[model samples]
Target: MVTRREVRLSPSNLNYEDRRCDRCFAEAANGESWPQGPFPGIFAKLDSQQRRYFTDRSTSDIDPTLPPGTLHNGGRVQSAPHAIGGVDFTIRGSMDALLRFDDGSVGVVDFKSSTASPQLGDAYRPQLAAYQWALSRPASDDPEEVSVAGLLVFAPESMVDTEQGRAYLVSTTWIP
Candidate 1:
């Protein structure tokens, strides 16, 4: 008898070895495994605000530091189920934002919030690369449309104020 398993892969799991293994094995055994954690309130708020900012560049609150391009949001990219070394798997990821450049090329943008300075470490490379690959093949299996396979990360600086609450300072960085 032959046993078949369906596995789902996400960009977040690219760097997590144990979690990835658990999910893969669970699916192979006809079980399911998902990441568990407490979502932070501040992170949620920041995510919402960033989405809004990308959707409406005309708004006064738009961050001037962001690259000049038309922004897109609320879309997910998925790959057809395929076997990797005999294990069936599907890779999918939700794009935080997509930037359409003046040159008619598209780029991926992921919004990140942190009290500390943000860095594009190796841990994040796979996630961004996945997004780049997905966006490239969107609409068809052709590669002519995908121009850049890189991502820009935006992290805003914040400051604390007793009266007004935690305020995001003017300084922001776009990590390429």
Candidate 2:
């Protein structure tokens, strides 16, 4: 027994609202308190290069700052859901880069250039997990298997020591 006004005011049946990720909400809240993002304007600066090199999966000159590994290819992939038991769970996500091995299997790679230390907390976990989760889901038409392996690449900014007049660099990678 519910009134029209009550139903109108409280739209609890909305899918978007109902599927809100608690971790995202909490992280957003925490982010509000922070002064800056991981690498302010880093993504923007890399946009053109990312679109050209990564999205196209073209081999570019290896970044000297990056670790000693031959970069094969890189690109982004979007995954759509088909069905999920009683409930229909549709997830959408994009990866920065997907690297392939000479043998087989692809690895999801997300590139990031930062001035701050990487935060590998649950907040960042779900974001990356969503990408893996979506990538794991079978394509809308294709019902075959999907790759779930991936990596996060963080290339820190190069800083020159005024006292020593030498350049120093730091980089890190995470896989899950």
Candidate 3:
């Protein structure tokens, strides 16, 4: 005699490790693993650059008294952190960040750090797209649409792996 086990599933409660896209999910069962990448500093550099541009373009409209960092809900979204569905129902990739602008427009921004060019990886595109989709869920308190955006900040390392490194600025991609 064989015993049957009841299984439960949900987009929100899904495990990040087991989630996967259609291709991967069809090929294999859910596995335990986290998205791999460098530290957050690389992404921070790119964000700093983007903010600089925002400041420049909206110099006149931007409130001078706004706090130093992102001011949305006192940066609660960034500070506290939140996660939605994965790339698949419960099996591959997870988005890194969800950004909301001051104009009531929500957007998805993925931070990528690479020694080489960002074009070398396809993961960045789908990963960001998945994030935008998850953030755009109707039940979610998130706004209607999160303009998909990808930022690739490349930082060349020193020969000895030291903090004194060189950073090359690349163009930021925004999907409106």
Candidate 4:
């Protein structure tokens, strides 16, 4: 006899594993597994560099209309197991960026390495919703009320020869 274990659903998987196929999503929910491709390293480098740039900075640096809140990175969030559409699941994901507004509410910001502005559509909103859920209802930390959620898209436009090395001119777009 076989027993199934609970699944730790990630925001990344919610974008693809759940949206691509119903059978795959159900199988995963039942503890079935599949090999996933390795994440490309370029995005990793971009994330690392941007995190450093935004560290100790303000949200207004990213977007002029933002709340001028303090910027935070590498925030890990996990939600206690709960039911969604009759299926029990837990949200576990690292926030790309979290901003603490002056009013004491938190803003959730996700970064996308892309040439076009990525919309928070069917493929992305669920992931943001998952982050919202985990931040507002974490398994360990005191609950933080989420005031806003959006994306910061980085698009590589041109390459510049710099003193250290070649750097890509990345254009950022804020989608609130």
Residue pairs whose backbone atoms clash in candidate 3: 18-91, 19-90, 19-91, 19-92, 20-91, 20-92
Candidate 2 backbone clash number: 1
Root-mean-square deviation (CA) per prediction: 4.9, 9.8, 9.7, 3.0
lDDT of each: 0.58, 0.43, 0.39, 0.80
For each candidate, how many residue pairs have backbone atoms clashing (under 3 Å)? 0, 1, 6, 0
Error of 2 at 34 (Å): 18
Return the candidate ranking by TM-score, descending: 4, 1, 2, 3
Q: Model 1, 65-102: lDDT tens per residue?
A: 44455766737887666676667766677877776656
Report the number of the highest-lDDT candidate: 4
Residue lDDT tens for model 3, 27-141: 3433434455775785566666555545323312233332222322112121112334423242123333434556555544444344434453344455455445545443235
Better TM-score candidate (3, 4):
4
User: Which whole-number lDDT from 0 to 100 does residue 138 have in model 3?
Assistant: 35
Better of 2 and 3 by TM-score: 2
Ten contiguous residues minimizing lDDT sum, candidate 3: 71-80
Query: Candidate 2 at 17: error in angstroms?
Result: 18
TM-score between model 2 and native:
0.47
lDDT of 1 at 120: 48
Tens digits of lDDT, candidate 4, 1-176:
54434568888677743567888886776778877789899879889998888877878888898876888884788998786565567888888989899999998888887644444443477788889999888889699999888777888899999999998898887776
- Pairwise lDDT winner, candidates 3 and 4: 4
